[model samples]
Target: MMTQGTLVDATIIEAPSSTKNKEQQRDPEMHQTKKGNQWHFGMKAHIGVDAKSGLTHSLVTTAANEHDLNQLGNLLHGEEQFVSADAGYQGAPQREELAEVDVDWLIAERPAR
Candidate 1:
């Protein structure tokens, strides 16, 4: 059966700091990303999975500083009935992209409280 929905998310994987190394240099591929008040330094793993079956369909890696929505299009196969993502993907550009592909956007909504 075709995929009914796609779930998209991103996680930060920490790496050793360059300053602590002998060369005092960091991995250029790794970068810093801030979520709320906290900061994380590493690489970002962007994953797309079949929501109903829980099978991974795609993955895209990038510097931690990259925005999740920037890689959203790459995660889709254009066969899902809808796409669900975190609130970070709730924006005009993202919505427009989903619209272009004729997929329903199911982005998480922020709580009122």
Candidate 2:
């Protein structure tokens, strides 16, 4: 059964950066983004899973440069009692679009290096 708590995260779906296609250009829909010290080129797959059942409940795709937090609202089902996400989603609660959302934000803190 679906639960009221949702876990949200994103992964990069990498694509070749070479412009070898018929148009001799990289896919317009894909974009480049940096992670840590490496640069990734492609799209991002944002997913929301039911915390209890561990089943995916929502999904959104966007250019790799898009911030994970930008898709937070779309990943939610609007019935969540709480939302859990990684440090990438920091400041999500402060976003104007999500300011009125009445749910606990269990965003993780980045570990000290």
Candidate 3:
């Protein structure tokens, strides 16, 4: 339901972060790629999930190095409640994109690590 004067939107964005694999391995997940001895790939699949019902609405996948704000507009459309993301999404443009759509782009605050 659309609010009296509020806007709704939705989108899929990729949050790319590289994490070192703690486990030892010989063969990589894919043989076509190689990096010295142990092949590694960093990837983060950003998905749009329903905030109210806690359901995934859509998804966007990209390389681990891809920027989260790079694909913000891809998911903008009518009927979006809001956007929720991890600290990796704490960027400037992301909030602006959602603002253009008149939607609340909520970012999960990360504790100082």
Which ranges of candidate 2 are over 4 A from the true structure? none
What value does the lDDT take at residue 38 in candidate 1? 88
For model 3 the TM-score comes to: 0.50
Clashes of each: 0, 0, 4
Query: Candidate 1: where are CA atoms >4 Å away?
Result: 19-24, 92-99
Q: Candidate 1 residues 74-108, lDDT tens each?
A: 89988998889988888824355645777788888
Using Cα atoms with residue i matched to residue i, what is each candidate's TM-score against the true structure? 0.85, 0.93, 0.50
| Cα deviation of 17, candidate 3, in Å | 16
- Model 1 C-alpha RMSD to native: 2.4
lDDT by residue (1-113, candidate 3, tens digit) is 33222111222222222322567442232122132374335443555545566455456655544565665656443476565566556663346554556556576676876
Full ranking by TM-score:
2, 1, 3
Model 2: colliding residue pairs: none
Which ten residues in a row are the worst by lDDT in model 2? Answer: 18-27
